[model samples]
Target: MSEKTILVWFRNDLRIHDNEILLEAVRKADKVLPVYCFDPYYFQRTASGISKTGSFRARFLLEAVADLRKNLQGYGAELIIRTGNPAEILPQLAEQYQVNEVYHHREVAYEETEISEQVETALWKLRLNLKHFIGHTLYHKEDLPFPIKDIPDSFAVFKKKVERDSNVRPCVPTPEHIVTPEITDAGELPTLSQLGLDEIVDDPRATNYFQGGETAALVQLHKYFSQDDVAVKSKSSRNSGSNNSSKLSPWLAVGCISPRQVYWEIFKHNQDGNNQNASLLKLELLWRDYFRFMFKKHGQKFIKAKTAEDEAPVLAVNELDFNKWAHGETGVPFIDACMHELNATGYICNQCRQIVATYLVHDLKADWTRGAAYFEEKLIDYSPASNWGNWAFIAGVNDAKESKYAIAAMQPKDMVSDFVTTWQPSPIDEAGDLMHV
Candidate 1:
């Protein structure tokens, strides 16, 4: 007879501390085995030529998994790594170990959600209970003031209601240790080449610098708050990515770090009488949670204009202007500079993201989904909700009634004054006709 145990399947919520599944699995099972999968589908090409998970995010994920394994090892737990479908691998392991329950974070993105459902179906066929928990956002799905059917369409309305009436439940406490299961043998993690990609370094000029995983995330919080010079400049200089902001998105995106951890760290600092930048930093986190909750409420629909439920926009990928916009030769200096940065380093400022996205959707008259897909391929911190939801909002397909921006000369002026002049050393002269705004 095989040993009985519970399987804790790791997904975006990677850390051990304050993780709902990690804490609960230890308490309920006689022995617990942790598992993570490098799904082959993640590295495969999309309909387009680009790899679904590009090199930058792939490298970051590799680092995050390494960090997570270390953290789990510290608790006398071992993580099982496999490169295949969870539906197939998980059920096989469950039966092989005589496991009854498989616990994991509840994912909302369309593909992941479908995969989870398939995994559940497979496990049910084996007579196992699949336990899914909400761990990504601060607001638990059950604790929401309204059900998914009732969540408001507008962000402002949702934000006001949650802030006023909804409170983030305290993080579930985590145990320091769990009984190790009889499963002893483990496999090695794949390198970039092993995962069908090549290793790459950070762009020399890019302002952001942070490693993947929980330890790096904690170190960032310490430096962001403790370093006097950097902290003082961050308030005004955050928009300038090359120097003044706390780049925590990569870790948070991969579940190497929890937003709640960042929130509590700053909250504690505020309580200790350091309030100058805490409020602003906290609001940035609120934005992250807001995008996450929006996805939860809308389900797969979050991807289409009305959302993923709606038909995909009619986008012509062969258009010449799109190629120009993508390659940083769009004739708008600021837009070009930002696009250049994103291409070189899988990161871009939030403000520039909105401007470039608007340009691609409205000015260039291209499909918003194309722009969303491109970002999904490139951004290190890309979340399914924020990337698609934002494109939908910008294209005037989702919540908005009218388009708020125009392309003519507004981009040139803003780029020259704000972004281009700052980043590009030898600025080019803008012809009079170029100032069409």
Candidate 2:
């Protein structure tokens, strides 16, 4: 009798802890073969002509993959790495290993879902099953108070309902030991240059302090919640020069950390006394869940801006101006400083993201997709559902109250004079045009 072999396909969810798919795989299979693919499509150039995976994100992912490989080895399993389409590589691996079935976490976004579908179809052709588990969001799909299609268009309403009715289940424990089939030659991880990205220099002004992987993610979570009262100070300190927003998004985005883990930690911390800070953090987690559910419900249509005819009127974008915005040369000093920060680093604070996005959509009048695509390329913490869904919400595509044409009402001189003086010392005229002082 042959041992039953299963393939564990690692996608965005890279961690071994509280990983439902990996847990089930180990429980059922006599032997497991773990695999990760650097999908070429993800590294290809976007329609906007920038490399879809920028150097900052590329380097982080490389670090994450390396860490994942190490962790799997600790469990006596090896992660076989490959570079190509997952739809193709997975099936070939299945054939080579004679895998009885495949297991992985499901993705909500259209492109990711499509790739999963392709792999499933390929596996079916080989008479093998491809199993998917929900692990991305704080709430599992089955545990939602309402069906995904019935989720409230308003985030506030959705949050209220979920808080009233639902609870986050406890995290699955990490496996003490994982069994592996007889296999050798666990392949080497790729470099940033190999992934078609240029080497990135560390930015002195970057506010982000994240390194990728499950181990790093755990260290950051403990440091943020247990070491100090960082939570109590978050709301007051956010958006100011002395900002202290919890910089947990990068790990969350990559599934290096699970939302349930974060939720429980904060919940436990609040037991000491009344802590509105825990409520605020949990609210942010709900918002993350809301966007993911919205993606599951609406699919690609969720990415569009709301227009009267279901088609947005094409705006005459000034390519030169858009380029300036992309490269941090926008003469509006505050906006320029934010853009420069984003370009040099892979991140900007949440407040800066909104300000720059509003400036581009309402001030520059460029299509919102352009800004979203650029962010996709740059952000190390990019989640397709959160990134595109937030863009749509900002662009009035989501069921939020529409934004007024108030860009003209904002006086650049009054709002950003001090910030500009510190971060961008160049003189600007009343209209925010660069001028010789």
Candidate 3:
């Protein structure tokens, strides 16, 4: 019999550690072929005239892929990089290597799911299988008390049930070494320019510099989970603009670290799971899982914001307000500060993000989809479910409660931080009277 070969396709789940797809590929195949396709779908400009993946996110991905290649090589395996559609590329690779099967982590969002279908269809004709592993969420779908179709519409009900009934599976261990056939022509990682994004200049005002890759993510996992600072629950994590809230999202977003890894570390650090900081962080992770599963349960129904039928404008002034807001030039100091931070750094505090997004939707009266689209282009940590889900939640489209901190942004003074002080706009009263600057 010919040696069985498994082609591992890396998507958002980029890490080698705690990755079920990688582990299963190693277990099943005599030789593993690791491939990452830089799908042009992500790089293309959207209808908003902004690239779907902006410079910061593009840079982060390129770095993460580069680091993944290094780690794979350290284990005596190579990452074959190719820039093109996965549907076209996977088949050619399967045919060339005489591969029997392909493996990857599954995604829930429509575009990602659609791409998976396209690749699966193409691979089927080649007489190969495209296997999907559901490894992205903290609670594995199989472990959930109910089936995906029956998942609670309310996060409160979902969280309570899952916490009571389900258990987090142990993290899969990182392989000490990986075996691969002697291969030629592992491709090169593309530059930001090659991906149709401009080279980014370092922003001095960014809260904290973010580096990409699983190696950096593991270091962060060790650092944050080990720190005894309960101040992680303070303004640092909750309200302020800086990355005091674990700074793990960027890595977490890209699958640099698995949710189970973070959860187990919290479990190891606080054996009883009673540490307030750990509990709160764990709760946020649960919220992340909620969004992913919500997408899985609903598909594209609630994920995409609907364009308003009556919001058509004559003066094109709506576009003017949007341009100003996107560039952080809005006169509203609080909202402007948040937008500035997001634009300058590809990040902002959770509350601050809500403040800006709410202002765009409720105050400016612009299309919520436009704000969502801008965040899609700009945020380095953007995930379809979380980003769009939260936007929908605030817009009152998705049935959810607005966080108190977000509600407080309307008060103006209550929400101001050093981030707001930096912008230094005129203070205003409840009546919209601008106080002397």
Candidate 4:
């Protein structure tokens, strides 16, 4: 009898370590095939008229996929790379390779869920089983204190309950060896130009230059916790306007590093002393989990409005103002600096994200959806749940109302002036008048 061939589809969950889908496939099948698809839809222009995947993120993804392929090779397996819709490519691969099963991490966001469903349907017609595992969150869905639908709308309530009740599962052990059926034609990875994106210039002023992959992720985790004492410094650094937060989101967003792995590391570090840091780290992870569960419960509606009773106030879409904001040309010095940093590096610290987001929604009175879409395009760490959820929260479209007044009350003129004097000179507006706040 021929060996049972199983195909492991790689999505955002790119890492090999603690990968439930990959682990399960290896256990159940005589041979496992690892594959990644660069869906063209993601590279295409979004509704906001920006490429859904910009150069920085595109380059990061390419690096991640390359690393994944290299790691798989070490295990005597190959990662097949393809460019197209997964729905079309996966089913064809199943037929061609006589794959008995397909395994993947489940996605909660609307578009990703739709694509998964399409692929499942196509596989069903071919008599192949499509299996999904929960690899994205720190706590498994089954282990949650409440059913996802019953999850509290208030993050505080939800966090209190989960922190008190939920347990963080240990990381899944990495497999020593992966057996694979003979395969030829391992496709080449795509370049940024091929993906219709221009090359990204490195920004020296950026807080961190992100390299994508499990190896890089693990190295970062060690450096932050061991050498940097991230826990002790994060709070002070944040208050002092130093970007010292654990810059782990990019790796976390892409599943290059599992949230559980991060949780355990923090847990181990806190076992000796300073439980405060561990608590803070876990709190952040819970927030990520909350967004994912919220998305799963609410679906597309999660991004639309906070509640049915609360109607979204009609806001005029200002194209010129939005363009200025997106390009970091807004004359408000601090806001402009943050936007310019984001545009250049595909990253900004959490505080700056809130500052710019509030500016876009409250000050500029532009549609929050436009800002969210732009972040989706530009952020190297873009997770649909976290990105949209944070945007909606700032836009006052979530259960919690962020204080727009408080954000607006902040004095940015001084900060911008200081930044300009210390750093690069501010971009000049040809007109004598600075752009209005």
- Candidate 4 colliding pairs: none
**Candidate 3 TM-score over all chains jointly:** 0.89
* C-alpha RMSD in Å of predicted model 3 compared with the true structure: 5.8
Query: Clash number for model 2?
Result: 1
- What are the TM-scores, per candidate, against the unseen true structure? 0.86, 0.91, 0.89, 0.91
Write down the worst ten-residue block by lDDT for model 1. Answer: 428-437
* Per-residue lDDT over 354-396 for candidate 1, one digit per residue giving the tens place of the 0 to 100 score: 7788778667778887888888888888777767766776766
Tell me the tens digit of each residue's lDDT in model 3 across 100-194. 99999999889999999999999999878899899988999999999999888787888899999999999998777788877888888988878
Query: Model 4, residue 139: displacement in angstroms?
Result: 0.9
Name the candidate, 1 or 2, with the larger lDDT value: 2
The per-model lDDT (C-alpha) reads 0.71, 0.77, 0.78, 0.79
| RMSD from true fold, candidate 2 | 5.6
Per-residue lDDT of 171 in model 1: 63
Off by over 4 Å in 3: 229-243, 304-317, 401-437
Candidate 2 deviant stretches above 4 angstroms: 227-242, 305-312, 401-414, 421-437
